[model samples]
Target: MRRLMMTMLFLSFAVGAAACGGGAKTTGADAEGKIKITTTIGMIADITEQVGGEHVKVTALMKPGVDPHLYKASQGDVRKLEEAELILYGGLHLEGKMTDIFENMAKQKTTVAVTRDIPESQLLLVDDGSGTHDPHVWFDVKLWTRATETVQEALSKHDAAHAAEYKQNADAYIAKLRELDQYAARQIASIPEGQRVLVTAHDAFGYFGKAYGIKVMGLQGISTASEYGSKDVSTLRDYLVANKIKAVFVESSVPKKSIEAVIQGAAKQGHEVKIGGELFSDAMGPAGTPEGTYIGMVRHNVDTIVKALK
Candidate 1:
């Protein structure tokens, strides 16, 4: 069943790509000395810029609010991959459907799966009897700090002349991540224990729940393609009613319908719940917003959760 679904999804994406004028061509670098770095998401691109500083030019394939799981690569993206000096991507199958393309790119380019460097023991598995690693490591500030270090090390190795600069920038970034971690802890602690239940559209917040003390409930599983079964809806409605959960959240990248369904279900069960502010889950906010950067993204999520639940 899963294989059939995957095939259908891929075919749809191919059809869409063909209709959208095939794909955009990758523009080559104009300058001779600049190192070209390509990242899968804007968050990764922002981190690479921090580490590479002025020495490298970075491009991100996925824009704000685009789910990486459903992201389709264009001809332009392929060209960027071909011309890149270094390619950085979040690993653990966060790119879901794009995993095969990135695996092929690994053979030809200096590709680094930033999240792959994280130790297996520290990662949480999203097993539903069948085992799979959860790819949302960025939800935990400490884990993301480690991932950032891995990215810096990779960049420094590739560009030895600016190794010192990359290392310094990474250190600074790591310190900021630590501060964010502390802040998140403090903010979440302010929410009463029972009210700390975090309900969202999908299972992206498992790491966030594990990092803090909240209990997270999602309508869908780790993959966006995972269908939300009636049993899942019933189970969540029961939990919300039993705990009197007052707020649930929708993700920017996911359709708001799933979360609204949860609210409706809760109401049917005689529980009153409101839609908490939309949270940046699989994607960050718009470029100029506070949630645009990795740090800002985490901070915004923490603030939203705290404000709604406390």
Candidate 2:
């Protein structure tokens, strides 16, 4: 039914755009000569701004603390998508509800998935028999560098005049991400190996664990759209008691109630588990905050995890 609603919304917007002569379509830049780019999530927006530098004016459709798994596009979002000279999004069903909208928009404008260039072998399967790969690629900074490159290449191809600047900025941004990847590795290593278990409200941090040599367990599945029951809570509680895991983290975009329940459950089992810290999972922090940027967000997550689990 939600998918139906999204489809209907897209159809209505498509008709409106057609009626308005393709919504006065414009490309390459606005009056300020800045490439008008629209990205689906804050992470992509940050990367676009970082790589495009002064040559792009980027707008993120989703704000901080938004869960992209169930995000639906509003008519206003359609307008933004229509107005953008170029559109970038995290693919692999990250923006699950908005996939059709993006697919249709790609037919009308330059739309690219930042994760398009990532090698499939590096992506983890959901293990749900759906053949779906995990969409939280940013948790692994090295993989996210490919996303940065995709953004650079997309911007360069769309606005060839600033190709050189885009390349330079992207290279610099990638270098910083490499440093962040190293930092995450070093920090995660500090946690006692046996206690290197990261529990969260959801399985969004699988890639983070894979990258940093931690065991990640979440009460919920890869997508928060998947429901969790009391049985799930009890199961997680059992694991915490069995492994003597000290802390579990809550996600900014997910409800704390789930983790709070896990904490209570662990307490009943005579194993106390505290919320290590709130990690940025599906979303980053507020616009001007340090955690708002991708690099800052990763650092905050790594530091939070190390402090909690060490």
Candidate 3:
């Protein structure tokens, strides 16, 4: 009788263990049920959150003010990519260094290149005759509205049940972008024709100038990773002196020492130029601030340019 009791007790303990294991598995599955997404930059992450609403969890690989061109992913980033249900990236080589890795991941997961939908004609090509594409499509509010719509479309495909919510959020965001575009037009108009020339640390503003009717000159090229040689500095200083450009701008993501050298060169040439406010070029502002969001970022940039140039 004692032997029979021992067998029964062992069976009961085994059943309890199986139940506990099943409960743990169910909890993990529940956590995974929430859709996980990853984006290349903070601005793209913000837009994805707006469209995904509470149904999705999103992570941005690049931090605020980090230069994406030179960003390299770590081992932890590989885990993030493996766990993500979908990945969104700004194409056109904005994340130049990570492009190949992302392309390989697309074969296994749902990867959407948000800027790929924009037409080539609208993109400003590099004038150095290298046929290189300009990756700064976000500078134009109108173009960015289309990019946001592409994101919404990709999200709808991933979660059809939440399509209506995504569309509603996208429409609201696009309306805000339209308002920002109009505001930028008005603010830029406040600057006089000759004064509209924007001299900055790099050529990142080419698309912005094209869209807003301003002449943009940069001390460096498209990629901030490259050094601005003495020849580039001399050319810019001469232009500033000849055109009498008053305000030279620095990018928040770039080193200020290079830009200050330009100012010093101008001074030696008998031209007075001041450091305009730091502009958000390659990255957005802090996560919680107004300049953090896409529309808010453009609004802040426009306000800064107008206030400085005018």
Candidate 4:
């Protein structure tokens, strides 16, 4: 019922955007000569802005702490999408509910997925047997470099006059991402191998674990939309007690109660599991803060994990 309602709502928004006067379809740029780019997640928006420099204006539909897996585009979001000359989204079902909307918008304007260019060999398959890979590629900084390149490629294709500038900007951004990847690897390596387990609210850290060589366990599955029950908690509790795991982490987008419940369950079993710190899984921190940026968010997570488990 919820999916059906959201789909209907999306259709209405699409119709309304077309019917509204003076909301004429935006071409390459606005009257100010800046390409209007709309992105689904802040991470993509930040990269677009960095690559676009002064030639493009970017707005993100999903804000900090927003869980993109369950996010449905609002009416205002539809208007933004309609007005955008180029739209960039995290693909592979990251924005699960808005897939149809993005598809419809693509037929009208330039819509691209940052993950479209990422190789399938690098993508981790979701164990759900759906034949779909995990969408949390951003967790691996090196893999995220491809997303930056994708943004650059899209911008270059849309506005060829600024292609050189886009390439220059993307090159600089990729350098920083490479450094961050190295830092994460070095820091995570400092933790004793036996104590390198990372338990979190969900399985969003699969890429992070794979990239940095840490064991990751989650109370819930890849998508938070998946339900969790008492069995899940009890099983995690036993795992924590048996392994003598010391800390778990909460997520910025997911409710803390689930992790809290796990803590309580561990306590009853005579095992203590402290929350290492909040990790930016599906979403980054608030705007204007360091954590709001992709590099800062990854650094914060790396530092937090190293502090707790090392």
Q: Whose lDDT is greatest here? A: 4
Cα lDDT tens digits, model 2, 1-310, are 9999999999999999789896555655787988898999899999999999998899999999899998999998998888898999999999999999999998999899999999999999997999999999999999999999999999889888889999999999899999999999999998899999999999998899898899999999999999999999999999999999998989999989988998999898798888889999999999999999999999999999999988
Question: Candidate 3: minimum summed lDDT over ten consecutive residues — where?
Answer: 23-32
lDDT agreement of model 1 with the native: 0.87
Candidate 3 per-residue lDDT over residues 124-163, each given as its tens digit: 8876787878888888888888889999999899889989
lDDT of 2 at 38: 93
In terms of TM-score, which candidate is stronger, 1 or 2?
2
Model 4 lDDT at residue 70: 88
Ranking 2 against 3 by lDDT, winner: 2
Clashing pairs in 3: none
- Which runs of model 2 end up more than 4 angstroms from their true locations? 1-28
TM-score of each: 0.89, 0.91, 0.89, 0.91
What are the clashing pairs of model 2?
A: none
Candidate 4 wrong stretches, greater than 4 Å: 1-28
1 against 2, candidate with superior lDDT: 2
- What are the per-residue Cα lDDT tens digits for candidate 4 across 148-187? 9999999999899999999999999899999999999999
